[model samples]
Every structure is written in structure tokens, then in C-alpha cells.
Target: MNKQEYMNCAEEELLHTYNRFPVVLERGEGVYLYDTDGKKYLDFAAGIAVSAFGYGKKEYNDALKAQIDKVIHTSNLYYNTPVIEAAKKALAASGMDRIFFTNSGTEAIEGAMKAAKKYAYTRDGHAGHEIIAMNHAFHGRSLGALSITGTRHYQEPFEPLIPGVRFAEYNDLDSVKKQITEKTCAIFLETVQGEGGIYPAEKEFIEGIRKICDEHDILMVTDEIQCGMGRTGKMFAWQHYDVKPDIMTCAKAFGCGVPVGAFLMTEKAAEKSLVPGDHGTTYGGNPLVGAAVSTVFDLMEKENILEHVQEVAPYLEHALDALVEKYEFVSARRGLGLMQGLVLNVPVGKAAAKALEEGLIIITAGSDVLRFVPPLIIEKSHVDEMAEKLDKVFAQIEA
Candidate 1:
């Protein structure tokens, strides 16, 4: 059917949870998506940083197909080979001791929260189960993750959230220190705050947090759902800081196009999380998602995915920088790899709509900051074309 018909049907039948755009994408390939009417748009957002493998890759498709033929799922009761392999790769990639898989990024954050608080509460008693999160952070919409996301715009509507979540100013270690009292159980942060306008944590800031965590005995948890999995030119963004977290939550791009999530932790936290079924998910480690995840690692290593991100992402960043330098409307440019941003001096919602009208898909982070999370496979030529289009678009914005 046509785009209008599809949207009308969805509006009538589907849940009104999302405020969707007008375009109804029918298919995607590489870094482009085609609407039902065959109109193509440069997929700059890359499904909100979830389509790391790009639109359709043969390896991912083949792996998923093979799994579909064999067995889609088996409960957590039985051992699933693909799930076991996925856990192995994920643990090795994170350099963490254990993992608990889930169904989405928020679920991963929820699991991370539980693991962090439990790690502290059981060890030092319940009174110390407080978490310190950054200002303007965006973890997820779940109750627990929502409680830690420092943006009140998202949390104000859903009040009466979990307590003990202290908001520290982003990139300010002094603020963090002031908030981290004896009751603090963890310091949870995004390695690069994706929804906080793509702000990367200062190296010194992260080091200070690590030091504080050590001194105060608080777990340091970094949410890498949007920044990890080669989105930041590294396997994990925390690696760039020369520091590791006590716990890490990763999802979004982990299963390629499929739905999955995982929260990993150090050996210390993993050992204590065992309360004889304290936490579990029906599809946590489902073999089908594991199959897709297993192939992701194979592709990551074989294709030198991180190397490609390093090589190509510079072009993407340079493109955005060129626009920022040329246009006064762009206030700032930040973020690593393809997870870059163009901080518009004005509200980005209109600019994003204009972008979609111009056959490009982009997303806004915090207010005026426009996020660009293109597919990992995007090349230099794609970068040049996108930059030119964006330059032309911004020029029209002034007119």
C-alpha cells in the first residue's frame, strides 16, 4: 500500500506510543531506505544507531535464516548453542566476567541497575543502594532506567520513580563527588551521552569517577547501548578513556536488526547477583537472537569493523565539522565516530522535518543538537554527498 494508507492503518491499529514521521519505509540497503512509493532517503540516523550492520547484509541474513530453520527459541532451561556463543563473544568483547541478556536497551539498563544496587545493597546493606547519574542523561524509558535518566522532561510525567538517584552535572567531577556520599551504590553514565547531545565524557572526568568509585566503593556502570558495538570507532567507548566499568549495559546494535539486550558485569558483581532466580527473561538468551549476535562478532572481527569505523567515521565527522564551520547556525559539533552531532542554534525538530522532506532521515538529541548515526558501512563518497546535501539544506533554512 501507499505511505498514507499504511500510516492511516497503523494509526488506527497500532499503539500510539511513537510520534512517527510521514515516511513509511518499505526496505533498506546499505545506508539508504526506500518508502512504499520507492522514494529513497539517506538513512543518516541508521534506525537510531541500531542498524550497525547496515540495511541488509548477506552474512546476517544467512545466519538468521539458518537459525530460523533449526530452532527459533528454547527456554532458558535448555542450553542453546548460539546463545552460549553469543555470551562468549559479548563477555570477551566487554572483558567482563558475566552477562544477563534481555530484549532491549531499556531492559539492559534495568538489569544493570538491579545488578549495581544489589551488588551494593547486599554487601553494605540496603541503606547504601543509591545511584549517581549525570544531568541530561538518557538511559531508557523503563521505571528503573527512567529513574536514573537525569532529564526531567522524560521523568516528570512518570513521577514517584525509584529513589536514591542523585543527579550530578555532566562532565563535572566535583558535582559527581559532592553527590556521591556513603549511601551511593553506583555511578551510572553513558560513555558518550547520546541523548544528552552526544557529549563524550572528559577523560579526566571519567578517571576521576573511576577513582571515586574505588575510594567510595561504588560501582561504576556505563551505558553503551547507543555508543558501543563499533558506533564509536571502538568495540566499547569506555576503552578510549583507559578505564573499565564495574558494569556495562549494551543493546540496540547488538543483535543487528533483531531485538535483544544484555547487561554485563565484573566477576565481583556477577558472583553476588545469584539469589536463586533473582532475575530472568523469557527471551533473554533466545537462540535466534543469539544466532544473529554470534554472526555479528564473526563479522566484526573478519571485516575489521572497528577499523572501518575508525577510517570512515573521520570523514563523517569532518563533513559535520565543515558544515559547522561554514554555517553560523551550527553552534557546536561533538561525539565520536559516526555518532556525531551538529548543534543547531535553533530548535532541531523543524530542521529534522526539513531534512526528511529533502529525502534524508536524521534525529535530534537534546533540543537543538541534531544527531547523525549513519550505518557503519557508509563510505567516504556517502559522507561527501550527505555533507553537500546538508550544506544545501542549511542554506535553505536561512532563506
Candidate 2:
């Protein structure tokens, strides 16, 4: 069937959750994707920053294939080699003492909340502990994750969400402090806010949050789901600020395209929270995703992905800045490393549709920001190609 036919079929059977683009992506290689109509697109979205190693890496694919032959899954009741290896590498990378794997970023957030609440309960011998999250922050779509998400529209329809989550202003330390009370057990924020536009947390603001958490004995949780795993030229964005979170939630590129996520905590938090029966998942740490997670970390080291990002990210930032300078509608460029955004006065949705027509795949964040989160494997040439395509897009839009 053709692209439209496939889309029609999908629309008939599948729930219409996403206002999907017209193209039907067939496959990807390196930093490019191809649609069913045999059109090529220079990918800047990286499947929303999940394809760290790009489309197909021989090493990563071989690891999954080999693991499939050995064992695809085993109950959490039994020990598995791949999960054990993944746990060790993840712990070392995050400098956290304990880890709980989940199937997605939302589940990781849920687990983190549970751990924080359990820690508070264990400490005070009571419940009803609250959590403070930043306004405009986007955690996830699940009930527990959505409750902590600060956006009102997303939560209004799903009314009466899990209560006790207070919204604070992003990068405003005073706002966070004002929300804290005896019942505040945890503070959650994205090290770099993704869906709310590409706003990197200010160093002072993140450090201040850390200090507040330390003084108040509250667990600091950084949502690294969108900015972690070498996307920010560091293993984690919080590392750049030298602020360690008591609980860190990671996904996205953590498994480099596989369905896996984890919430890691310090030894102190671990000792006081989420004992055996407190949390469990049948497929969370199964060997299939375990192999994917372990191989992702291994390839990150063997290929020096972080170093590549460090070198190329500045070039991307510079190129985006040039567009801002050249175009009247382009207002500014903001973000860290490869996760950048170009703010525009025009409609971002129309611009994105035009980009797709120009054989480029880009996405938007917030309402007016053109989000550029290319694969970690992207080169300077890919950035150049993206700039060229965007230049045409801007020109066409201006016309």
C-alpha cells in the first residue's frame, strides 16, 4: 500500500492521539530517514531525541540479536546477566547507589515519586508528603506523571489528579522555596526543560535547588529523560552544574531507541525507601531491554559519543544563531549541546510542515520554538544541511 493508504488504515484502527505528519517513515540510517514514497529526510528530531546512536548501528543491533538468541526475558524473581550489567553501568554513570528499571520515562517518574514518598514516610512515620515541580515543565502523560506536570490544560481534562503537587516557577529559586513546607518531601525539575521550549536550567538556579534540598532534607529529583545520555555533551546535564540529584529519572536515549527507563537514587534515599514489595515490574529489567541498555552504554564509551557531541554541538548553536541574526521572524536561539531551539514569531506548526516538504524532519516545542534535537551521531555536514533546508523554509514562509 501507498503512504496515504497506510495512513488511512492506521486512522481506521488506531486511536487518534497524535496529529501525525503526512509522511509514513519506513526506516532510518545514520542521521536520515526514508518514507514509504522513497523520499529522504535529514532527521533533526532523532525520534524526539531517543535515537542517540542514529538509526542502525552494527554493534547495537548485534548485541540485541545475540541476546535474543540467549534469552529475551526472565521474571524479576530470577537474576539475569544483562540486567545486572546494565544496572552496574547505569549506577556508575549516574553516581547513584540503587536503580529501578521501567518500561518508559513516565514509569520512571512514577517510580521516583513512589520512592520519594516512601522515604518521607519512613522518616516521619507518616504519609501525605508533597512534591514541588516547576511550572511549564513536561514530565509525561500518565496519571502520576501528569499530576506533577505543571501545565494546566494537560491536567484539566484529567481533573482531580493525584494531589499534593505544587507548581513553582522554572529558574526561580525563590518560587521553589516559597512552595516548600514541612510536607515537601521532593523537588522535581528537568535539568533542561524540553517540551516547554529548550530552556536549560541556569547554573545558579539548579545549584540553589540543590542547596535548598540539602538544607531541608528533601530529595532532589532531576528529570534527565530528555537531556541525559550525552545529549548535552555530558553524561547528564546536571553534571555540568556539579549538582547531584538524590533521585534522577532517565529514559529517552538511555537505551538508545529501546523501550527502557530507570530511576536511580542515592544510598541514603535507597536505604530508607521502596523495600522489596514497594515496587516491582514484570518486564522492566527483562533481558531484551537489558541488553539494549547495556549495549547503549558500552557503545557510548567505545565510540566516544560524548566527545563527538561536545565538538558538534557548538557548531549547531552557532549555525542556529546565524539564522536568528539573518531572519526577522527568528527571534533567538537557546538550549545546550545538540538540544537547541530557534524561537520564531511565526507559526511553528506551519514551518515544520514546510520543512517536511523540503526533505527535512524537525519538530516544535512549546508553541513557537523550532526544536532541533538531532542524533548524537550527527556531523557538521548534517548541521549544514539542516541550516540550508531551514533557510529555504524560512524564505518560503516569509514570502
Candidate 3:
């Protein structure tokens, strides 16, 4: 079937959740994607920043294939070699003493919340602990994750969500402090807000949060689902600020392309929270995802993916800065490492659609920001190609 036929079939069968793009992507090669109609697109979205190693890396593929032959899964009741290795590597990467794997970022958040509440309960011998989350922050779509997500519209329809989640202003330390009470057990925020528009946490703001958590004995929970795993030129975005979170939720590029996520905590948080039977998942860290996770970390070290991101991010930033300077509609460029955004006066949705037509794939964050989260394997040439295509996109928008 052709592209439109496939799209129509999908719409007919699938539930209407996402307003998917017009193109039906067939496959990806490195930093580019091809549609069913054979049009090539320089991919800046990178499947929303999940394809860290880009498409079809031989080492990653080989690891998965080898694991497929060995074992795919064994229930959490049994121990598996791949999950053991994956856990050790993940703990080492995050500097966290304990880990709980989940199938997705949302599940990680749910686990983190439960752990935090359990910790507070263990300490005070009571429950009803509140969590302070930043306004405009986007955690996930699940009930527990969505409750703490500060956006109103997303929560209005799913009213009476897990209560006791208070909203605070992002980057405003004072606002965070005002929301804290003896009942406040945890504070959640994205290290670099992805869906809220690529806003990196300010040095003072994140550091201040650490200090507050330390003084109050509240767990600092950072959602690094989008900005972790070398997306920000560091293993985790919080590392850039030299501040450690008590509980860190990670997914996206954690397993590169596989479905896996984890909520990790320091030894201190581990000592008081979520003992056995508190949390369990049948397929969270099964052999299949474990192989993907372990291989992703192995390749990260073997290939020096972090250093490569550090090297190329500045060039992409420079190109984007030039666009901001050249275009009247482009107001600002903000973000860290490869996860960047351009704040525009024009409609971001229209601009993204135009870029797709020009054989480039870019996405939007918030309402006015054009998000750029290309694969970590992207090079200077890919950035150049993106800029050239975006220039045409901007020109068309102007016309």
C-alpha cells in the first residue's frame, strides 16, 4: 500500500490519540529517514530523541540478535544475566545505589513516586506526603505521572488525579520553597524541560533545590527521560550542575531504541523505601530490554558518545543562533547540548509541516518552539543539511 493508504488504514483501526504526521516512515538509516513514497528526510526529531545511536548500528543490532537467541524473558521471580549486567551498568552510570526497571518513562515516574512516599512513611510512620512539581513541566500521560504534570488542560479531563501534588514555578527557587511543608516528601522537575520548551535548569535554581532537599530531608526527583543518556553532553543533565538527585527517572535513550526505563536512587533513599513486594514488573528488565540497555551503555563508552555530542552541539547551536539573528520571526534559541529549540513568533506547527515537505523532520514543543533533538550520532554535515532545509522552511513561511 502507498503512504496515504497506510495512513488511512491506521486511522481506521487504531485509536485516535496522536495527530500523526502525513508521512508514513518506512525505515531509517543513520540520521535520515525514508517514507513509503521514497522521499528522504534529514531527521532532526530522532524519533523524539529515543534513537541515540541512530538507526541500524551494527554493534547494537548484533547484541540484540545474540540475546534473542539466548533468552527473551524470565519472570522477575528468576534472575537473568542480561538484567544483572544492565542493572550494574545503569547504577554505575547514574551513581545510584538501587534501581527499579520499568517498561516506560511513565512507569518509572510512578515507581519513583511510590518509593518517595514509602520513604516518608517509613520515616514518619504515616502517609499523605505531598510532592512539589514545577509548573509547565511535562512528566507523562499516565494517571500518577499526569497528576504531577503542572499543565492544567492535560489534567482537567482526568480530574481528581493522585492528589497532594503542588505546582511551583520552574527556575524560581523561592516559589518552590513556598510550596514546601512538613508533608512535602519529594520535589520533581525535568533537568531540561522537553515538552515545556527546551528550558535547561539554571545553575542557581537546581543547586538551590538540592540545598532545600538536603535541609528538609525531601527526596529530589528529576525526570531525565528526555535529557539523559548523553543527550546533554553528560551522562545525565543533572550532572552538568554537579547536583545529584535522590531519585532519578530515566528512559528515552536509556535503552537506545528498546522499551525500557528505570528509577534509580541513592543508598540513603534506598535504605528507607520500597522493600520487596512494594514494586514488581514482569517484563520491566527482561532479557530482551536488558540486552538493549546494557549494549547501549557499552556502546556509549566504546564510542565516546558523550564526547561526540559535546563536540557537535556547539556547531548546531551556532547554526541555530545564526538563524535567530537572520530571521525576524525567530526570537530565541535555548537548550543544552543536542536538545535545542527555537522560539518563534510564527506558528510552530505550520513551520514543522513545511520542513516535512522540504524532506526534513523537525518537531515542536510547547506552542511556539521548534524542537531539535536529532540523534546523538549526528555530525556537522547533518546539522548543515538541517539548517539549509530550515532556511527554506522559514522562507516559505515568510512568503
Candidate 4:
């Protein structure tokens, strides 16, 4: 169907939750997407960092097809081969001892919050199990996740939210220290903030948090939903700081486009919190999604995706720096590895719309930042193409 047909069906049948772009993408190959009318677009957004291995990887496709022929899903009441295998791989890579899979990053955040609260209650009492989250941090949209999310605009309408949650300034060690109370259960943060504008946590700040958490016996929860799974040239973003979180949440590229997420805990928290009946999900960790997770991890290792990111990230960063140098409206660049954003003098939505019209698919974050989270498999040539297209978009903005 054409774009109009697709839009018509969506308008009639679907809830208008998102202000979606007009183009109807029909297919994707490598780093390019094609609309039904045969227009091509360089896909820098990568489905908001979901398609890490790019579109239609053969090994990934084969793994899913084989699993489909065998078994897609089985009740968690029974053991399944795919889940067991995937769990092992995930735990091994993440350095976490226990795992609970969920259907989305928001669900992972929910599970992590539950576990943290339960752990705190188990130790002290059920009286005051509060959480400390960073300001401008974007967790997820569920009530539990949304409560902890730092953006006030998103949370104002959903008030009287999960009580006892407080927000602290990102990368501010002193601010975090000031917010801590005896009631604090967990200190949640994104090692590299994503939707709040691609700000990577300062190493000293993370270290300070680790020290404080250790001192107070508070659980440290890091949300790697956007910056994990080799996006930052590391299996996990926390690895970059040389500090491990007591609990870690990951999704997005976890299944390389499949809707799967998980929260894993250290052995200590695993022993104390979320004992069986405390938390559960029906469709999480099923064989079908497990296959996707397992395949993504396997391909990342076999293809040396981390090394590739290490090599190409510098080039992408340099190109973005060049853009900053050339364009008056481009004020700053932030992020690490493939997850980067350009702070703009104009509204990010306007620049993004113009880029889309110029055959480039880009996205906005934090209202005034244009985020570039391309697939992990993107090469220098693709980066060049992106730069060229962005140049045109910038020129249009200047005019």
C-alpha cells in the first residue's frame, strides 16, 4: 500500500499515541529503508536502536526459522531449551548471576524496581522503600517505570505516581549524595543517558555513586536499555566505568529487533530478593524470543561487533565534530560509540523532519537534540552517506 493508504488505515484503526512520520517503510536492506512508493532512506535511527545487526542477517534469520519449526513458545511452568541456552549466554555476557526476561525494556525496568524494593523490604522492613533516579533519565512508559522517569512533562499527567521516588541531577555526585535517605532502596541511573540527550555518565560520578551505594548498602541499578548490547563498543555500558551495578536492565538491541528485555541481578541480590513468587511474566523468555536473543549474542561475538564499533566509532565522532565545526546551528555533540546526538540551536523536530524529506531517517531526543543511533553494522561508507545527507539538511536549515 501507498503512504496514504497506510496512514488511512492507521488513523481509522489505531490509537493516535504517536506523531508518526508520513513515510510508510515497506522493507529494509543493510542500512537503508524503502517506502512503498520506492523511495529510499538512510536509516540512522535503526528503529530507535533495535536493529543492531542491520536488516535480515542470515544467521539471525536461520536461527529464528529453525526455532519456529521446533517450538515457538512453551509455558514457563515447563523448562525449554531455548530459554535455558539464551539465559546462560546472556548471564555470561552481562556478568550477572540471575535473569528474568520481559517483553520490553519497560517491563524490565518494572521487574528491576520490584526486585530492588523487595530486597530492601527483606532486609529492613516494608515501611519506606524509596528509589533515587536521575533527573532527565528516561526509563520507560509503564506506570512503574514512568514514576521513576525524570522528565516532569511526561509524569505530570500521571501524578500520584509510585510514591517515594526522588530525582537527582545527572552526573552530579553531590546531588545524588544529598538525595539519599535511610529509606532509599535503590539508586537507578542510565550509565549513558539516551532519550534525555545522549549524555554519558562521567566516570568520576559513577565511581562516586558506587562508593556511596556500597557505603549505605544501597542497591545500584543501571538501565542499559539503549546503550547496552555492544552499542558503546562494550557488551554493557557499565563495563566502561569498571563498576558493576547490583542490578542491570537491558533491551532494545537485546534481540536485534525482537521484542525482548531482561533484568539481571548480582548474586547477593539474587539470593535475597524476588524469590519465585515475587515476580513473574507469561510470555517472557519463551522459546521464540529466546532464539532471537541467543542469535543476536552469537552473531555479535562471531562477527566481533565490539571491535568493529571500536574502529568505526572514532570516524563517526570525527564526522559529527566536523558538522559542529561547519554548522552555526549545531552547538554540541554528545554520547559514546554508535549512540550519539547533536545539540541544536533550533528545534530538533524541525531538523529531523527536513532530514526525512531529504531521504535521511533521523530522530530527536530531549526536544532540541538530533540523535543518531544507527545499526552496529554500519560502516564508514554509511557514515559518509549520513554526513552528506546531514550537510544538505543543515544547509536547508541555514537557508
lDDT of 3: 0.95
lDDT of 2 by residue, 1-399 (tens): 999899999999999999999999999888999999899999999999999988978999999999999999888999999999999999998889999999999999999999999999999999999999999999999999999998898999998899899999999999998999999999999999999999999999999999999999999999999999999999999999988999999999999888899999999999999998899998898999999999999999998989999999999999999999999999999999999999999999999999999999999999999999999999999999999999999999889
TM-score of 4: 0.99
Q: lDDT (0-100) at residue 339 of candidate 2?
A: 94
Instruction: Report the Cα RMSD per candidate.
Output: 1.2, 0.7, 0.7, 0.8
* Residue 293, model 2, lDDT: 95
Give one digit per residue, the lDDT tens place, for model 1 in 1-399. Answer: 777889999999999999998888889988899998889888889889988878879989999999999999888888999999999999898899988889999999998888877877678756446899999999999888899999988999999999888999989999998896778888999999998899999999999999998988778999999999988888999999999999999988898779998898999877766455778888888989999889998899998999999999877877788888888888788989889998898769888888888888899999879999888888899888787777777988877
- Which lDDT values do the candidates have, in the order given? 0.88, 0.94, 0.95, 0.93
Backbone clashes for every candidate come to: 0, 0, 0, 0
How high is the lDDT of residue 140 in model 4?
96
Q: Which digits, one per residue and each the tens of the lDDT, describe model 4 over residues 1-399?
A: 667988999988999899999888889888889999999999999999999988878899899999999998787899998888999999999889999999999999999999999888888967578999999999999899999999999999988799999889999999999999999999999999999999999999999999999999989999999999999999999999899999999999999888899999999998879886788888999999999998888999999999999999999999999999999999999899999999999988988999999899999999889999999999999999999999999998899
Task: Give candidate 2's error at residue 80 in angstroms.
Answer: 0.2
Better of 1 and 4 by lDDT: 4
Worst 10 contiguous positions by lDDT, candidate 3: 25-34
Candidate 1 — what's its lDDT? 0.88
Residue 170 lDDT in candidate 1: 85
For candidate 2, what is the TM-score? 0.99
